[model samples]
Target: MSDEAAGRRPSIRDVARLADVSHQTVSRVINNHPSIRPETRERVLQVMSDLQYRPNRAARALVTSRSQTIGILSSSSTQYGPASSIAAIEAAARERGYWVSTANIEPRDPSSIAAGLAHLMAQSVEGLVVIAPQMRVFRALAAQPLDIPYVTLQSTELDPTHALSVDQMAGARLATRHLIELGHRHIYHLAGPQDWIEAEGRMRGFLEEMSASDIPTTAPILGDWTAEFGYYAGRELLRVRDFTAVFSSNDQMALGLIHAIRDEGLDVPGDISIVGFDDIPESAHFWPPLTTVRQDFAELGRRCVDVLLGPVGDSAPVPATIVPELLVRSSTSAPRPL
Candidate 1:
């Protein structure tokens, strides 16, 4: 062999030759096939290590006609929900002897999302999972005819046939109901981006609970699910002196709202109670621990994969909704009697 070939990364054929085994045997060993003899397996494994051999995933997929890789199409993979969900999906996929390929789409436009989906398809992904939380994405999905197996994460009104989501509405209800039990009658909701499904679901849940209890359903205060928006909204809220409690769509907004309220000389759980969603890692460390809903993104990821790989059969598409739990903390308290 030329020096150039010798210096290149070791391939399956190299290991096969070194171990005196056929290329098929090496492939089986790489895939952990059960039929390989124990002694032969050890020999092949040692040769692989000596050669520093690594299997080419693409080549393997070509051979087996199974990529064993799922495609994830998402916007803002760095954000709390999508980031956590992606990590969870990766872990879950690894456990199932599969891999993941992620494509981060910009602004979650229908065209851009469609392009990302096409890119994943080109990679020969076995399944697709879309993590765009906006209603527009669902509309885009409706516009396209995706014949491949796919699922969506927490979309607003997705086709029941191809979508799955965490139960954001249920989580919001849990938060609202908890506050009601604490004697908070006039609750204010700090909503996330008006365009996001999660924001809408949480708002809907809060309204539904209030309506069921014969409480008024006022329009929610809109924010962009950012600490800056929360802070700004909180400052504006100080001008209206009527609300007893506030429920933010996510924890970042809650944190900013808390800061804003404190800056206005109002004490948390003393002057006004507060609650947030997502149960972010830092919620416990806030000035007053944040009472929030915990959405298990990891579980969402695992279940998405399950639905994608499992037999859909003749069963109609049924969207899976994972319920979140409410974590009671120091941020909430009984409202002072007016």
Candidate 2:
């Protein structure tokens, strides 16, 4: 329908007029306020239905001193973790009748980060979710006090009260232990960039598991969470002596490693096995489907919004840790015989 033909959608005032009630009574019905009488509430609701009335979110927020909007500051929306988390938060907020405002942040600049936060504040958002995974962003958050409730997603060292994240360390341990259980004695780690919390957590998990097993640690191969970096790291490993299996920090990097290994005349599982994290959609389609850890980004986002909107009288902020599950696929196997 044409915008004009929609003929100016009906308003709360119109519903109130039809129901023979005050605007406040209509609002109480709309908000499901506990004090509203059942008969009065039903009357208001029926009138609203008859009039096709829609509440003006902004105007209502102003009257109640609430914006009913939440702000999200995120890194690239393409990456699996941040992207999935944002989608989840949006879905959860909508379920609760809240709106979402998003800001895309470049990882490098402090000013850009500040500007994004300023914009959300200007919009009068009731809460904020920070999806930046770097230490710098964490430092920025620490340096400033936020008037609205805020939470950090995937943060490793954040104050427990305000931080929510998947247990990357736990996920990594699951991946490493899976490989170890398959009789792969010489396991190597292909790590993500050191500055990222996901990378650090995965590395810690791998190390802890290896240490617990009394297996000597090999120097980790480093990458920037890119397919290209994984390819390079894979090529370098090809030049070194042998290892039975490799654990990559993410699915993209593992894919790169797979290609590089094949280019060097090796076959996955036949020559060496591989495991990856993130379990991106395409992981299953790889030449040999990838065995991986699946992080619940959506759950993380939902929990973040819940924490932000939770009653102030609730118990102190407790760090919530999400455990990732290990997905076994064709990419992993028992070690090759000597």
Candidate 3:
């Protein structure tokens, strides 16, 4: 019978009875004791589900003094990069038998950051994952050192000790080098917003590569990391076919650039080659497919958890940087024999 039908909420005792295990075993399963047999854990979990048993976090905390939860503090949670990282963290946490609580706040406001941290602290989270894309957020975190362990997804010498990140600059350099190697000396760059750490890193990489090749360049068109900006930028750049290639800081802008090129009756890699960053899912299916950099967000997420919580049963040292990969697709090619 359902717990509702029984006229009382099911208890740990009820779960132990149904699963044919002792109450102690049930408690171990509840607390994610690593030594429990797989079959026994499954049986206990099944029974808990069948009885609609919800462990009282309050009572559990009182007894064990461990909340067994991880808090995620994100500033740009709505963006693809931050969102992907968050999903990866949640999956890794689940594998370790832990829960995740996320708090999103405006990165610019110190008060908002304080409030967000406070909200997470109230849950007694064992650790924290800070997805602070903005430098100010990291500065705020530095000012108020966290009581529990925390990890940040930043690499700009801001907090290298506690940082777990993909080498964004390296990824950008790879993209720029590909275009230059393709024999396209006249290359333009579509960069993200000025203040964003990622945008700055990518622009710097692009500039470094261009300068290293002894290629003179014009100012890059600053973009908002949107298809709309890319489209307009592409349209404006097309007015004078001065450049044979353009490297976009992100895929959305590349998509817009592609659309603008097609609208002008031009071709990708034929009239101009395009390369983008962040191989979002739809990039592969774009008209000619986008050539871009792929950030291993899933692995990044795993490392995020491992740094603060340590590997569940393994002993792998946390890496300084998870290098991104360049995905060369149909969007780029040698600038049509000059």
List pairs with backbone clashes in candidate 3.
Answer: none
Residue lDDT tens for model 2, 210-254: 999999889887788889988988888888847989999999999
lDDT of 1 by residue, 1-338 (tens): 45865988888888888899999999999878999999999999999888778888788878777889999988868789889999998998888878999998875566797888888887789988888887777777677777678887876366776668888889999999999999999889999888788889999999999998999866998888899999998889889868889989999999999999999998999988999999889999998999999998787877887888872357544348777999999999999964
Q: lDDT of all predictions, in order shown? A: 0.86, 0.86, 0.90
- Per-candidate alpha-carbon RMSD to the true structure: 3.3, 4.3, 4.1
Candidate 3 local lDDT, 1-338, one digit each (tens)? 56564898888888988899998899899888998999999999999998899998867876688888999999888888999999999999998888999999998799999999999998889999999788888878877878899898854578877888888889999999999898999999999987678888889889999999999889989999899999999999888878889999999999999999999999987888999999999999998999999999999989988988887677778886889999999999888754
Worst 10 residues of 2 by lDDT: 310-319
Candidate 2 Cα deviation (angstroms), residue 73: 1.2
The lDDT, on a scale of 0 to 1, for candidate 3 is: 0.90
> What residue runs in model 2 are displaced by over 4 Å at the alpha carbon?
1-59, 311-319
- TM-scores of the models, in the given order? 0.89, 0.82, 0.86
Best by TM-score: 1
What TM-score, to 2 decimals, does candidate 3 have? 0.86
Error of 1 at 247 (Å): 1.2
By TM-score, is 1 or 2 better?
1
